[model samples]
Target: MVQIKSSKYLDFLSQFGVGGAHPGGLSLTMEVLKNESIDETSHVLDVGCGTGQTAAYLTSRYDAKVTGIDIHPIMVEKAKKRMKKDQLPVEILQSSIENVPLQDAQFDLVLSESVLSFANASVALKEIYRLLKSGGRFIAIEMTINRPLDKTEETDLQQFYEFQSLLTEKDWIHLFEQTGFQHIHIHPQPSQQQDNAVLEDYHFSESIEPETFEVMEQHFEKVLKYQGILDYRIFTCTKG
Candidate 1:
């Protein structure tokens, strides 16, 4: 069996079996938003919108008009279903971060949480720059390595590393600057408290195939190592 990577992993994560947005890993994603101010009426683009949690939060908390895009079709479908269920007007699309299909300068707030690492970081940042109007804000909850890694460690974390094209914090900062962002800031956010109940519920869900369950079990161990390499950060950048 092929090991899950990129869009396939996202599709796996979107299912109820995985407890999509319940892991509270996105606490950092939420923290980044709390530190910034955005116009309620601004058109927002949520790149790599995993299951619509952040998009819904933006609409409910900031009243922003949200267009959420993800490479995973399953995620887009679930997000759309979630929005419809809540009577919220957010639009969800199945798309890629490397090649966003939206028109240029169409968004005022561009936000990505743990998403850009899944693509070419520089290219995604540049695409984000192109989409946002001047003076727009870009916020992300991302993994940033503290130092360069040895080849052994890199090989050990191949699946985790390949699933995300992670960069050191310095590299990410340089990319942000090069992409024409200003007033960049990065804040560390630790993982949320693990709820055994949530984990139990997730374990009991029917959508998880036996093979996927085994992969996720292995994946979690790798995630811990990856997070250790990169201090988890809530990075915010402003479009110039």
Candidate 2:
């Protein structure tokens, strides 16, 4: 009779070491980065970087100086292991994105993948802005509802994922504007492709609780029930 609720779902994902847990997965990530002006000299920070999938790709693909941070201990450990195994010099840190100990204006780019909704978006945005150099860009592929949800709908979904708030596209824009971000853009989401088994990105933990098995069922049910209402968007902006 065990079950997972709230942020326990995050623990489930972490224990299973799910990679590309973000919406649209790694294929979309590759497509999105193609538009960015990244190179070997650029310094990049991947906030809430789960298991370092994107971080590894950033290093191998663009050869950018990449650093990854996540609040989950298991995730941080896995990310570090990935770096060590691949011999990639990507620095991985275990820290909350809301108040990282990094200096101001230190990164050329900051990336958040399906992470901010689970955090205090306002606080995290400010910290991300502080970490970016002048004219530096910030991009996030995060949850974005198309419209507001009623109390029941809101409670059910928010409780499942432990989202601080379910933000609409407009709500997200307001947060960005209030955070003093400039040239904010909501990019079109790519069509979700099927998971490629050959490139499967799961690194299961040595042990998993029986309660965690119910999480995937409940998650699928919610996604089906909400459908279009639970969609996500790609948000891009710059710090002045």
Candidate 3:
């Protein structure tokens, strides 16, 4: 089993239990889901599902059979706790996207929100492909660099987020195609920072590390430093 080394930045997000920590946050998630062909009978998988916010929403909104998996222990625990409190019948597991412990062709939809870049995208994408039924959809909201970055620029962002590689829109499509995903589509996202910053909810852990505070501060700093270069894209494709 491949494990994601816990970086301070990732640890901070997990410890804080920040739902919608992805670029567009949960509102974007709702918008994306609205366009999908989901029903109560559909089986959905949320890879790198931090804290189960989206998983819970899937059950509440579409009444879908949802399962969420994350590599971080804290995230898995919090996600489980969330389901227990909400009384939602969502299964939360601690696992890696590269090698998920689930049967193939089980899910109608699989989602990765700001997640694939943090792990081996090729391996994870292949795994996602195996998990989805033929004609099922796979949605990803991931960071996409508009242009190639200078080594210094790339290193700064990569080191901070611990991403595998800074992928562009084209690079991502190539990956999808390589994984046999057909009917690839890039959905335009409404700028989350257009008028107001996306509203974020936090469930703070009991024990907070001082360094974790620095992680959040540095996160905001990187967001400012990178700006347009650190943008994200919503890619939706079908398995065929």
**Which one wins on TM-score?**
3
The reply for model 1, stretches above 4 Å from the true place, is 1-8, 17-27, 188-206
Identify the candidate with maximal lDDT. 3
For every candidate, C-alpha RMSD to the true structure in Å: 4.1, 3.6, 1.7
In order, what lDDT does every prediction score? Answer: 0.71, 0.89, 0.90
lDDT of 3: 0.90
Flag clash pairs in model 1: none
Question: Model 3 shows how many backbone clashes?
Answer: 0
lDDT by residue for model 1 (1-240), tens: 212245435545665523224334445455556766766778999887877877877898889899998876667777787789889999988777888778999888888777777788888898999999988888876766778878887666555446456578888888888888999986654555544453232213346566655566666777676676755466788887
Which candidate model has the greater lDDT, 2 or 3?
Answer: 3
> Per the 3 Å backbone cut-off, how many clashing residue pairs does candidate 1 have?
0
lDDT of 3 at 15: 88
Per-residue lDDT of model 2, residues 5-91, tens digit only: 248779888989999998878878888899899999999999999899999999999999999999888888899988999999999
The full ranking of all candidates by TM-score, starting with the best, is 3, 2, 1
Clashing pairs in model 3? none
